[model samples]
Target: MRNPLADKVVNIKPSGIRKFFDVVSEMQDAISLGVGEPDFDTPWHIRDEGIYSLEKGRTFYTSNAGLKDLKIEICNYLNRSQGIDYHYNNEVIVTVGGSEAIDIALRAMIDGGEEVLIPQPSYVSYEPCTILANAVPVIIELKAENEFRLMPEELLEAITEKTKILILPFPNNPTGAIMEREDLEKIAKIVIEKDLFVISDEIYAELTYKEKHISIASLPGMKERTILINGFSKAYAMTGWRLGYACGPKEIMEQMIKIHQFAIMCAPTTSQYAAVEALKNGDADVAQMREAYNQRRRYLLHSFKEMGVECFEPFGAFYVFPSIKEFGMTSEEFANRFLQEEKVAVVPGTAFGDCGEGFLRISYAYSLENLKVAIGRLKNFVDKLRKEQGR
Candidate 1:
């Protein structure tokens, strides 16, 4: 019998984050800081809305584009939250999650062998999704010195004639790097000059510590050329809901919706009703949660300082990437050793991208008590390594 798997699907690597998560699950006393999920429950009101919808027998499938009410709420939320305007009818698409939104957007826009510029240490899905879309994924290694923000020069250097899309993963996963307004302005200029489009994944938008998350779509000349992907998973603690949306040019959105129509039918009808509630009444809840995450974020930074571990301060997202290079171990080795020695699980930075070597991603999503214990273990691990190296 002949093997029948497509090589493209066969070649995709399983997510590295999940590999360690599976390992940690078997350890009885292990404390996991590896998963990027928020620890908070869905806000009571949002959950209540879902219950109300189900109780009212609103379980039917929504339109392929999702509920119009939800789309309107999404547009209003984006405009109110980010100063960007989008038409609910034509410019926005509701999908299974930000993940599906990403998949559809790439499928809609990418042609065979088109080049997509992806900055390293980003969300793990982008590269694989691009490959499945039949596009070539070109990784630009962002640096620790720039706080992992993509330099315009780097963008320019990577662009070739085949370049068609850029995946902007800011308030980045693992590293927690955020691109500021001015930083985006620089890259926006390059994108316009080069006639490139962008897929901006701002799923971590509301989790910024001291800064407001800036969307590249809000920049001049960008609204028409950017596909902005966001959802409730991060901000509203609705990961299980699997709801997200994409807003962008009508032409592109039409293509995305076509793919979504055949592929998804629509996002969950129950989830859409609940999301409308999230957008309408969940702002205060988001603020409260953000403040809580901010406290945890600061504590992690201070703890790293006290331990003398070298890591750049992260202002956005729920994870921090700390360098383990001083210990003279590969990230995987350090993480495995830490888990064995301390029963604390952290994702090796290589999980994000190859450039993430010598780093580890520690999520602050756990409670302060759990994090404190985890950090105590981590400090001990690092200190022992220090002693061994005489550093």
Candidate 2:
């Protein structure tokens, strides 16, 4: 038989997070902090809307761009939340999820051999999607001292004649760092001068704990050059709904819509109707969930401090990147032993990127009760490691 696998697909690594997730799934006693999913159920009203849509027999496919009303709601939500204006008819396309938006945006924009700037310890999809799009993935290694935020100097240094798209994974995954407006202004100036485009994944925008989240597209001279991708997954706890949308200049969005039309046809019809409800009426529910996550986040940080673990304070998203460098073990080694000895599952930082080697990404999306139990196990594990090293 012939070797049928494409080299590009074959060479791509499977997600490291999923590997641990699968193992933890089978270990009935294990508790997992590896996956980035929210623990909250989709708010009842949103689910009720989906049920209503089905009861009305609204299961047919929407337009390739999406239901006209959902597109308008997406624009309205963006304008209401971030003050960015986009035309619903041309600038937006609903996608299967934010992951699909990321994929199609890269495919639509890159013809081949272009360089895509990706910051490390990011969501796992960017690098692989760039490769699949036939583009070069240039990684900008984010530093822990800067709280994992991408600095302007780093972005400037990564640009080249061939650099085309920059994937800004803020309110970042695995690291939970967010870029403030001042930080984004510097980057926006650089991007404008360099004449490069951006794919800003703001999926965790509403989950930000600091001041309100800002979209890079709202910055001067940026809206035309950036594709903003977000979805209901994090904010409304609608992960399983698998609905997301992308907004950009109509030129790029048209190409993306073309790809989405042929490939996905449309996002789930029931989910789209539910997301409309989520956008229009789910604010209080989101605020409540955000507060709960914030509480859990604080508890974990306090627990880490008492255990003498070094972790930077993350103001956005539900994960914490804690340094495990003092343990005299690789992140994988520490995580493996922790899982086996403590029966607690947390992701090795290197799962996101090589720069994540000395850290571990622990998600706080789980409940406070579960987190308390997990931290108790973590404290014992840390103390045991310190004693073994005679520290």
| Candidate 1, 302-389: lDDT as tens digits | 9988988888988898988999888889999999999999999999999999999999999998899999999999888888988898
Candidate 1 lDDT (Cα, 0 to 1): 0.93
Give the whole-model CA lDDT for all candidates, comma-separated.
Answer: 0.93, 0.95
Candidate 2 ranges beyond 4 A from true positions? none
Where does the lowest 10-residue lDDT sum fall in candidate 1? 382-391
Worst window of 10 by summed lDDT in candidate 2? 20-29
The candidate maximizing lDDT is: 2
Among residues 3 or more apart in sequence or in different chains, the pairs in candidate 1 whose N, CA or C atoms overlap within 3 Å are none
TM-score, each model? 0.99, 0.99
